[model samples]
Target: MMTILIPATVAAVLGGFALRIWYRRWKQQRIEANRKVEAPNSYYSSRGVRQQEDRERWHSIKVGTLHPLNREEVLRLLDVVDEDGVSSLSRKDRLFLDNMTLPRMGV
Candidate 1:
């Protein structure tokens, strides 16, 4: 009984360690692959995201009206910054984000 318990415990510990290492390596590989895929796409993320669902409602609004970035767009932009770093933003996207940082009126 003692020998069985000891081996079982050792196996569990070793298995946990092996799983941890494999998971770390797997995560690194997946992240590298995603970065490679997204490298070219990082630019398109800022300006060309087509909000088809939202656009249906916005169609009534005049084209020239200054539309604020909606909640999801803000979150996606933040995710882009988190993933790719600040330098990833185009000048226009950077300025747009900069303007977003300003204090709002009557809040």
Candidate 2:
């Protein structure tokens, strides 16, 4: 009876652990499957209200408007963040980067 109980208990614990791991992987896959993305047909036109908004956005990002975080400065800031996490940034650096817009790729 003792020998039988030991083997059964071992099997039950191992089976439960395997089931837990499987369940976590399944949950992650389910979350990934349900993730949201922008619609392909979504469109914005540069006219009327949109035109004015774009102008304002451009003005807001204009030099002398922000704290002198140019494209090169922003790139260096990103490199620092990559090397030593966001927490390593100075308060001023964090404020500057957080408020600045992401640069256009291939620019």
Candidate 3:
């Protein structure tokens, strides 16, 4: 009876340890697979194109060729100032124009 009990107890303990190791490996593999699935669609891929477009748009606005304060424009000059910065306006007159027209446009 004692011999049988000792062998059975040892076997149970070894089986428990094996199960724990297997569970850990399975969990690690699942996490890695999830990361692979989710990582590619993130903003990392389009960052360069988005940045380039933003730079060109800002340059056009700064040079006055792309004035947002124009009569049929969707965004006002103040919207540009708020999204970009006041330093992008280049002159006090442009800043005053933005301040004046933005309120009239209900921006």
Candidate 4:
């Protein structure tokens, strides 16, 4: 029984060591592969940066009036305005729309 236990313990220790070595090698290989894959010109490169800047410039020009509605007020307004006409909308709906939409139009 003692002999069996000694060999079993030795086997477990060796198996754990083997697994650790295998994992280390696997991790190193993965890192090398990632480096090789990312060696080409990435989005952080100069040309990519220039392209991103150009996109931002175009977006600034084309950006129309976008009202930043508060989530709570927007939900409240949605609740007040049903499928009926604007006349059915509550005072809260009108106020919510006025507060949100006017500033965004640069009014």
Per-residue C-alpha lDDT of model 4 across residues 22-77, encoded as one tens digit per residue = 99999999998888455564545575564344333322431134433455555444
Each model's lDDT comes to: 0.56, 0.65, 0.56, 0.55
Pairs with steric clashes in candidate 1: none
**For model 2, how does the per-residue alpha-carbon lDDT over 1-107 read when each residue is reduced to its tens digit?**
99999999999999999999999999999999999987654464435654344334333444555454376576676677667655566878766764675442232
lDDT per residue for candidate 3 within 1-107, as digits (tens), equals 99999999999999999999999999999998888454654545465564454434433444344455452242454466568764465565364554433232112
Which residue pairs overlap in candidate 2's backbone? none
Best by TM-score: 3
Q: What is residue 7's positional error in candidate 2, in angstroms? A: 0.6
Candidate 4 to native Cα RMSD, angstroms:
15.8
Candidate 2 residue 6 C-alpha distance from true site, Å? 0.5
TM accuracy, model 4: 0.35
Show model 2 residue runs off by greater than 4 Å: 39-107
In the range 1-107, model 1's lDDT, one tens digit per residue, is: 99899999999999999999999999999998888444663434332242332223223333333454554455556567667766565767655554545433222
> In order, how many clashes per candidate?
0, 0, 0, 0
Q: Identify the leading candidate in terms of lDDT.
A: 2
